[model samples]
Target: TLLEGVEEKIEDITNKLYVVLAALIKGNRANCSNFAQSARLNWLVNRLQSQQASSGALEVLHSVLVDSPEVLNMITEAHILAIIGLLDRNGRDPKVLDVLCSLCVNNGVAVRANQNLICENILQRRDLLLQTALVDHVTW
Candidate 1:
């Protein structure tokens, strides 16, 4: 089962499972996109809501979002919003927030991201504040 490996109590095994899943999603983005947009993706996202196994699920999600922008289109706005909400809840992991911020570069995000406080977080990065602000504004 897809959840079996991820549900392992062993940390190394769980990380390895995430690596394999991320590689699979990257290797065949089209098929993965089909899967990512299905109910299965919802199940995977629910994994992120869990406290123990969320990091592995988050790693897979971050990899997919970074490696396959088209998959983002396959994901619904509500799911994306949920991811952003997760970012706020799990703000300790900067990579997750970075992935969410990267989505701001996508089209139609201005509307979907209205409720997300992406700007406040971006402002915290002095190096990216100006560049991101300009880019986000221009892209909008």
Candidate 2:
């Protein structure tokens, strides 16, 4: 069984397993330091940085980012802020944006603070303002 195989490979599964275990135990209140110190996080970021060369890698990362609670918790507030800032400046993929918004909501983080700023930025782009207003009002 997969559980038995995983048990056999326990030592080789990587620190992400421990980080995930901690998050599962503590939920949204999980300590951020474990994520910050994780080698697995570094590996994930490196993999994302190189994703342009391989679309399959991007899909894998999108899956991890969207589906893994541990991976979601591993995202620091600084990283979230940066991504929101980038979305404000350059727009964003709707699917990815939805995933991010959902993650923020699920993690019990206040998405309103930066989400408002991003909406305002989008509004500055002419006809998009109305759409932004509608989304903001609904989400709020």
Candidate 3:
């Protein structure tokens, strides 16, 4: 029932909802633009702050970056920090890095808009970046 769902923690719900939202918006330009313009953009960015939900949030973030051109200009410094955490924070959470890889591999407008900032942060934290790669590459 609706009440039962309400009893579930919002973070738990959003973990799945983010992926569903990402699937819904992937390759859909209008929805992507709407997501960027709406308060949902803030939600997506803030979702990255949640250790429980950041991975699903990353999925939605990757989908939006791949799908929305308008999102590039809309990004903020805080957003950059959140995305940076994907590479070197939260202990290089594999799920987070996997979606971060999508951003790198896709290199859409949002990633390009943020690359200089991202690069600067990466360089400033060289040891962290190397550790992330080592962890990501380790087979066992």
Candidate 4:
């Protein structure tokens, strides 16, 4: 099957998944959350941790996490770890920051991961990124 083949391929799986998930999420939110808890999603999160995530994948991930906060409850620790790492890597990316900030403000997995992300990633590098003169002077 095409879905099974996508699982086997490594080259463009993340990008392919971005399209698949975007469509799935819109078709049925509950099923999408179930899919998010699957091993395939675990693989996707692992890719994000390795910095292999595409912009589309990250955008869909943010949308899923923010739009369906209940999904956070179903996500595994591995997912949390990957999300934390992804957030750290893209702290300066506003899309990532926006989703992460919303997650931190909400309950469940995000609430638990919030302290760690802030203390270890965002806060640790505050002056270098968030509070820098460049951020204040430049737009975007």
Candidate 5:
């Protein structure tokens, strides 16, 4: 349903959604804690399934983590990883017309291969991506 749109404007609208989400949580301690403890964060985690929404998800997640330190201290079973890296495009990403999260790096290779695997849509990998994709410190 997310991809269903005028096509050209899908990205614009998606970016705007992130702007709204970011504005709602930025520097708000209570909002951040509720987001961390509530099921609302699942929506953002699910958004990561879409390559289109993944960048904004990360940016918004960064804001959440930065605004609330309690989130980290409460990571008993899981944790969040604010990964920093550069996405060196081997070629022009024609499919990706625009990106909300900028990967400003000089290197050509980026690690966190687990993320690539979980997000891949191969015959077997597709099941894993659909069933359970890691969003904790290791993958993100």
Candidate 6:
């Protein structure tokens, strides 16, 4: 059966799906966070970290979170902070900085309005990013 075939090839299917989903997210063609998360992006990140595929995985995650213009209003403050923290820790990657800037400029208002406490909690982090020499290279 077609479903059986798909199930049997879950890993291949998921990898292909990730490619498509990553493209969509990078192109800003999808606005649904649920769809993005459904792709197991976080799981992919963990897998990448485990396998030392950090660069590729971070690239996909950055595209989904930053390049995707679809602002996920439902994302929790903690979640946003977590992404920021990850970027801060591994932000030496150029792509990570790009995504961080987008979140700061594009999603900043919604984040501040919805989760003032969380926003405040990460103020130092934000400020540090701003102070970084790389900050100038990130536009919007």
Clashes of 6: 0
lDDT of 5 at 110: 33
List per-candidate RMSD values in Å.
9.8, 12.0, 6.5, 7.5, 13.5, 10.3
lDDT tens per residue, model 2, 68-109: 446665665544444444344435545346535654554465
Those runs of model 5 whose alpha carbons end farther than 4 Å from true positions after fitting are 1-5, 73-140
Which of 3 and 5 is the better model by lDDT?
Answer: 3
| Candidate number of the best TM-score | 3
Give per-residue lDDT, candidate 6, residue 1: 92
* TM-score against native, each model: 0.55, 0.37, 0.68, 0.57, 0.45, 0.46
lDDT of 4 by residue, 5-98 (tens): 7755753765776767766675466755654556656665655666544555666666667666665565565565555565556656665565
Question: What's the ranking of the predictions by TM-score, best on top?
Answer: 3, 4, 1, 6, 5, 2
Q: What is the C-alpha local distance difference test score of candidate 6?
A: 0.53
Candidate 5 per-residue C-alpha lDDT over 29-99 given as tens digits, one digit per residue, 9 for 90 to 100: 88878767635555554454444434565566656656665553333211222121112221222212112
Q: Candidate 1 at 68: error in angstroms?
A: 3.6
1-140 per-residue lDDT for model 1 (tens digits) = 76777566566676678777777776466745655556776777666665454666776776666565665555666666566556556654675665575566544454255234455544554343233333445443
The sequence of per-residue lDDT tens digits that candidate 3 reaches over residues 1-140 is 98867756776776888778878988898888887774777777776876544667787787786677567567677777787776655666666655455544444324564567767777898776575533446454
Residue-by-residue lDDT tens digits, candidate 6, 1-140:
99978765765565566566566666554543543553464564454444322455555666665644454443445445655555556644565555445555554544345345445655756754455454547567
Candidate 3's TM-score? 0.68
Better of 1 and 6 by TM-score: 1
Cα deviation in Å at residue 114, candidate 2? 10
